[model samples]
Target: MNRDQMEGNWKQFTGKAKEQWGKLTDDDLDTVAGKREQLEGKIQERYGKTKDEAKQEVDNWFDRNGW
Candidate 1:
């Protein structure tokens, strides 16, 4: 999903986000609050991923979820 769409539908997507990245806590996702850059940073922090890797994974997740 695009940035606005994500921000608007963040509540709906949070469950899927948790499913996709179980290491991330609800508080972490809440802090991200559907901001793509923040989501990438959180993923990197929780998963020990590089920035590009986190971005790529988020992109892939978006595709998989058809968001």
Candidate 2:
């Protein structure tokens, strides 16, 4: 989803986010709070991905979910 949409529906998306990235803790999601940059950072941190890789992954996810 786009950043504004994500922030608006953060609660609804949290479960899906956990499913997609099981390594992320509830605290991580809370900290991210639907911010795209934070989510990208978390993904990079937890997945050992480069920043560009994380950004592309997030973009692909948004596309896949039709967000």
Candidate 3:
């Protein structure tokens, strides 16, 4: 899914995000809600990953699963 779709479907997607990264909090999900930039930023902040890395990870999951 693209960023807009992901944002629109965040309620469903957040569960997947949490399943992937158990360390992520509800606040993190809330912060990232409906914003691709915010999602990448929060993932980077929480996971200590580079921005590109975080985006790639999210993108990869989306592509791999055809979500």
Q: Return the candidate ranking by lDDT, descending.
A: 1, 2, 3
Off by over 4 Å in 2: none
Compare the candidates by lDDT and give the number of the best one.
1
Local accuracy of candidate 1 as per-residue lDDT tens digits, 2-61: 799999999999999999999999999999999999999999999999999999999999
Clashing residue pairs in candidate 3, if any?
none
Tens digits of per-residue lDDT, candidate 3, 15-43, equal 88888877789998898895877877878
Query: What TM-score would each prediction reach against the true structure?
Result: 0.96, 0.93, 0.82
Computed on alpha carbons, the lDDT of every model, listed in order, comes to 0.94, 0.93, 0.82
Clash counts per candidate, in order, are 0, 0, 0
Question: For model 3, how many clashes?
Answer: 0
Ten-residue segment with the worst summed lDDT in candidate 1?
A: 1-10
Ranking of candidates on TM-score, top first: 1, 2, 3
Worst 10 residues of 2 by lDDT: 1-10
lDDT of 1: 0.94
Residues 1-67 of candidate 2 have per-residue lDDT tens digits of 5678899999998998999999999999999999999999999999999999999988988888889
Q: Measured by TM-score, how close is model 2 to the native structure?
A: 0.93
* Residue 65 miss distance in model 3 (angstroms): 2.5
